[model samples]
Target: MSIKVGVIGAGGMAQYHIAGFKQAGAQIVAIADLNEAAAQAAAQKYGVAKAYGSIETMFAELPDLDAVTIIVPNKFHAPLAIQALEAGKHVFCEKPPAIDAAGVQQMKDAAEKAGKTLMFNFNNRARPESFAMKAYAEDGTIGRINSAQAKWIRRTGIPGFGGWFTNKDLAGGGPLIDLLHMVDLAMYLMDYPEPAYVLGQTFSDFIDDKNFKGPWGIPDAGGPTNVEAAAHGFVTFKSGQTLNLQVSWAELVKREEVSVVFQGTGAGGKIERLFGTDGLDETSIDSCELYTQEGGNSVNRSIVTEPCEDMGRSRSAANFIYTITGEEKPLNTPDQALSLMKVIDALYESAKSGKPVAC
Candidate 1:
């Protein structure tokens, strides 16, 4: 039987979830959102059977929902995921896991209690380049990674003047949280080692500047711009591994770039995306390459795969469905999410205290 799915959001990200679920042979039975009109419209557009103004209503009506995919704002991720997990349903939540580590731990505990699968949309892991890089890391081609540098920097790319994207309470801590894909990817390639501490700093130089707004066209919602515009951090792991991360929604730079470069004992590899326009992955050029010595000479090899325009957004959703059906293992786990959130929380704390914070 096909998995019966409920989508818990009517926002822009919902479309990808719906499409990916349906493509993976799941039945998207309903969609729920606070805005009834938006929910109804999304249901119609996506050929869903039902729409509800609230998650409670949908759960009450669709008692047989096998799973739910959460595409809500950053603040609501943990609460909604726990609600679904505790109800005996598998959950696929969007990134950052939660606003902080404690919430992700709570969600993790809920899923453990319910014995249900809890996965986060660390979508970059689904990218072809990521797949290739991970293969190298896992198969001893790259050997043990000693250190890595992860960057998701933009020249002029704040989401908006003021709104959830800029509000610290709503979006966590801006690009350090929002653009954390590379950091996660780097850790994934390195096998998610236990982090020891984080040393970091944040900058909000252009948080309220309209000129630095991204090309996504999200209108100003007129709220407090309390989030940082950029962040830089270094993390040391208990296994003696190290990672450096730089993320920013707005900064002085040549172009928007997303990359994770790692140096391993046997070789070095890099997965990078250089954007022609900010926030549009389709317009960006991507490359994956490995550096090593062959026969006492320099050897650089390009690991090419089929192009990914959406940066594996829908594919990440599809992976959740595949995991539930036992066709594939999950790309991300709730435990890993807890650890990642701890690192993020520590980075923010470090940025605030101007000192290193234990993870």
Candidate 2:
């Protein structure tokens, strides 16, 4: 039977989820948004059977929802997911599961009590580069891991100064939350070690500036900008491996930088990505490369990119559906989300206190 899915948040991300659900052979029963017009439009565009102005009505009216995607802002992730799980539906949430660690825990507990899945969307884990690096790390092709460095720097991308993207109350944080793809990918590739601690710093120096605007933002004339525009942190795992991460929505740089590099005792590899017209197309996607000592000389070679039938967001959606339909199992569990949340929560705390925080 085709899974009956209802998606909340008729925003840009919801469109991707709608397409992905279709690709995964799930029937999109409804689209919900606070803006009823937006919900209607999305329902029509996605060929969904219904449009709801709120989750309450969606549940009260249509009780056949087998699954629901929580695509709303950071603040509502926990509550919405909890409600959905209580409703006995499988919940799939986008990245940065919640604003704080406690909220993620709540969602986790709720899912457990309901005997439902609480899969977090770390979609990049399925990307070619991320998948390849994971293989190298797990198979010991790179030996014991040493350290990892990843960054996603956007020179002038402050994502809607007045909207949820820039509002601390709405977005949770700036680049740390918005550009979590690279950071999450790197950590996922590293197998999400037990983080021991985090020392970090954040800055919102340019939030007041009207000159810098994001490539994708709803410029509402001018509004509040209360989140950090940049953040950098160092996380040390209990196993002694370390990860250094830096993310920025606005900076004084020539261009953007997005890469995940991992080092090990024996070999090292890196994947640098370039954005393209259609997201990360073949031309823009980086090749998985390895650097090591061959005989008496240094050698750098490219690994063959295996054919992946589904990847990125589509793969994530398909896998979620697969797990629900008993076709496959889930890779990103709520426990991993909770662990990742602990590190991020520590980073935010460390940034404010100017001290290292134990994760």
Candidate 3:
């Protein structure tokens, strides 16, 4: 059976989801956005049959939709996902499932009541380099992991100056959410260990300063920006593993960068210089080098790059459909999303208080 999917946002990211869905052989049945013309344009572009100015109307018209993808602003994630789940549609929402813990909990409760699948799109997990790193960790190639470090740094990459991207209320935090791809990837490689505590800080000084010259050559229009341009955090896990993470939209660097290093008891390995272009046509070389603590020998492995596969968004969409059709187990349940949100909440609290917050 073809899975009928609806998209709730027609923005830049939505196009990626739409393409992934089409490539995965799912049906794009409907779409909705606050901007009706944008929704219509997306529907036409994707060959979807229906477009609506509101989600309520879209649900009413396409009641049989197998699943829906919520890609709207961060604030709307919880409400939109809850409504879809209550309507008996499985949901695949973008990362940082909700703006806060309370919203994420509500969405989880709704999914539970509806007995539906709810997935947060942690797309970074699907990258080839990420996959290879995860396999190495599980295979004990990295030994007993003790500490990990992940960083995503940019020279001057503030997104959508006057738009929701820079607005704290609309997008939550700036680089924390924008560059959370690394956070998700690092934690995942660490086997999603329970975070014992988090300590962090956020800085917005550069963004609002008039004399700021962005690292990426982006001009700094000095003005009030509500979001942080850079953030750093330390996370301690229940298994005694610790993670140090740094993310930034603007910095004193020349190019964008993302890297993860894992230190283990037996051996330590690192994946450095990882990132991808917008159209999926280009991606950073993912390389791993392993060093044995006991032997004092180093083995560097170059990860072969293949055509990037749209990591599981469409497959995740298909999984949602299969869950509804009784063909497969749920790919992402609401419980998982709630847990991810809790981590986000703790990270923010730790940042604000300059202390470790228990998760």
User: Of 2 and 3, which scores higher on lDDT?
Assistant: 2
lDDT by residue (188-253, candidate 3, tens digit) is: 767677778888888876775434433222233333368888888888888998889888877776
lDDT of all the models against the reference? Answer: 0.91, 0.81, 0.73
lDDT (10s digit) by residue, model 1, range 1-359? 99999989888888888778888999999989999999999999988889999989999988999999998779999899999998889999999899999999999999989999899889999999998899888889999999999999998898876778888888887999999999999999999999999999999898788889998836799788899999999999999999999999889998999999999998999999999888887779999999999999999999889998888888999999999999999999987898899999999999989999998
Q: Decide which is better by lDDT, 1 or 3.
A: 1
TM-score, cand. 3:
0.87
Q: What is the lDDT of residue 45 in candidate 1?
A: 93
Off by over 4 Å in 1: none
- Candidate 2 residue lDDT tens string, 1-359: 89999998887777667766777799989988899899999888877889989988999998888999988889999999999999999998987799888999999999999999889778777666666777777888888767999888877677666887777887788888777777777677677788999999998878767566765666654546788888999999998889999888877766677788888787998877654422334435456789999899999988777644334776787678888888887868888888888888899999999999999
Which residue pairs collide, candidate 2? none
Q: What does each candidate score in C-alpha RMSD?
A: 0.9, 2.5, 3.7
How big is the positional error of residue 128 in model 1, measured in Å on the Cα after superposition? 0.7
Give the better candidate number (2 or 3) by TM-score: 2
User: Least lDDT summed over 10 consecutive residues: which range in candidate 1?
Assistant: 216-225
In the predicted model 3, the residue pairs found to clash are 155-215, 155-216, 156-216
TM-scores for all candidates: the values are: 0.98, 0.93, 0.87
Candidate 2 positional error at 264, Å? 1.4
